[model samples]
Target: MNKNFNVIAASMIAYFAYRELPSDRLCRSAGIDKGSMFEDATMISEEKIRNLWVNAVKLSNDLLFGLHFGESLQLSALGIVGELIKTSRDVGTAITAAANLISTITPLFRMEMCSDEIHFVIKLLPTERYDHNDPVCGQIRDFLTAFTIHELDGLTLKKIRPVSVIYPADKSNVPEYERVLRCKPSIGDHVGITFEIQDWDMPIITSNYELQQLLLQSNATVKDRMSSEVSFKNKVTNYMLSNAYLGLPSIEQLSSNFNISSRTLQRKLSVENSNFQQITDNVLKRLAISYLKEGSHTLKEIAYMLGYNDPSAFSRAFKKWTGFPPATYQRNEEH
Candidate 1:
């Protein structure tokens, strides 16, 4: 199955607001439901996203539509970028933070930032999973390039402009594109813009140090969750939790899913300060507690659900897991 990716639906909402076009018509043309396109959904299929760009261009009859839409988008309308602006101490930090957030959270186009002694540059690069030949990809690239420049200018109180602009092979001399870009862009294999080092350090007028620290704490929490999923132990635990309804997968089953030998899997888990049995016990303990709290199943049924041979076996394990027999735990929870 193709994985759906998270996108800022509000950015698309701003697109319609920019072009003064009915989003319902464009979204429908893209084979998407209008109701969820802008209001509630954040996950969109790659196909629909491309279709949306294509349809918007077709309906609006404008090739530089993304440039205009990007210019029209307000910095405050960008939830992540808005947070980045108010929380970052300077333009460099704000732009870098926004780029990192977008790249980390979305699969469409990953933004990368790098700095040298005299300049800092940001690039809008396609990820390995996407097909660059797709028209929608090109359109989105244009949109993002313009949007980045516009947001940077807005947040920095218009104190800075790109020292250099490098555009992809598709060059347009359209007046609107020229007006937003400001600089004469050179055609290159990559899409990026560069700013002087001094301009990058311009302090954000509304930036708050306290808010930036709080944002750091919040970002660290999210990073920890993401990193936890990357751990082998957590991956195995998640697998057990998700498939437990069919009866928790044994170490052998999990090892097979991961395309490794069972002994190898044990060694890997041990390296993570965990082992199969320990993890299995932990998962069962959690599930058993949840089941007991729900109070929907008898001890015998709960035993069977946990894959025990009999109620006696489950009761013994449950007692060891929680220091209370299944019936006692369930009764206590109910009361």
Candidate 2:
């Protein structure tokens, strides 16, 4: 990735268009373009995408990032529709009625129940960036934590653990997690924050007698919304790893195989939060480390596998990346 990323008010734009703010200065500071983020998806890497989100939370100073954004759009739209149906039901009835009609609001991003184990998981597609304390992410977590607690009254999460974050958390936010989640939420790690529901079988406050049917339907919709493109990226990376002996693919070859224009292919990957060169480097780096650990291939063979014609050139590059030659790394590992 170019490392030039900008923080724009995309969610605000989605909510109150007038509230949208230009991220040009932020991008300029971060070395990215503000105007082209919506169009030039490749300009934003996953880390950068997540950074934008985290910045949003900091910019807004609110935890209900997702809900606030959603309220402006989905929830607001639902309220308009709910007025026609609001007078006809109880709280539970209103909830059930809202769930069915709110699919439009819930579709782009949402939470769904899965069996007795998982309460709600964030499902977002067509989003490139995500990070801890990301206004949207924080908003979703806050909404889930608060809504779940409010709805069940007795149900409260024991702890909130974040599996991923672009940056570390401060002490102030730590206590808030303890209070809100009834458990400390871990940040900068790769484990989901778990909320233990004592009565997993408790029914939602909805008019529908068959709560299972609604949950099942919602789960199915979430599964259906998941794109298969994530798997495709893994495949491409794996292919690069195995064929390291070959030189980098020309843009034409990659585009031809994927049935897309070179530019379109690049842009699509950017939307997915990465670019070809970035993935290629990551794959190569992973494979290079593994090969070094094995210590079986000769320098010449290793060089060839990495698409370098000369051992000396490969050694120089390796030293630059890892600050050690292959022989020294292999010997240290063996020791």
Best by lDDT: 1
- Compose the digit string of candidate 2's lDDT tens values, residues 19-117: 222233334433444345456454555455455555545544454443333322222222233342334333333333434432333222333332234
How much is the lDDT of residue 184 in candidate 1? 76
lDDT of 1 by residue, 1-335 (tens): 12212234435533453333465677668786644533443457766766777877887776666665555343323345657755788887887777776654346688888889999888888888557777666676777787788666446534256888888745555444555676878888878888888877888756222322322332222213222125667656654553343246667556644445799889988998999999999988877776666655667756765677678988999899889988888888778
Off by over 4 Å in 2: 1-232
How high is each candidate's TM-score?
A: 0.54, 0.31
Where does candidate 1 clash, by residue pair?
Answer: none
- Scored against the true structure, residue 122 in model 1 reaches a CA lDDT of 89
The positional error of residue 228 in candidate 1, measured at the CA in angstroms, is: 45
Candidate 1's error at 66, in angstroms?
2.0
How far out, in Å, is residue 192 in model 2? 57
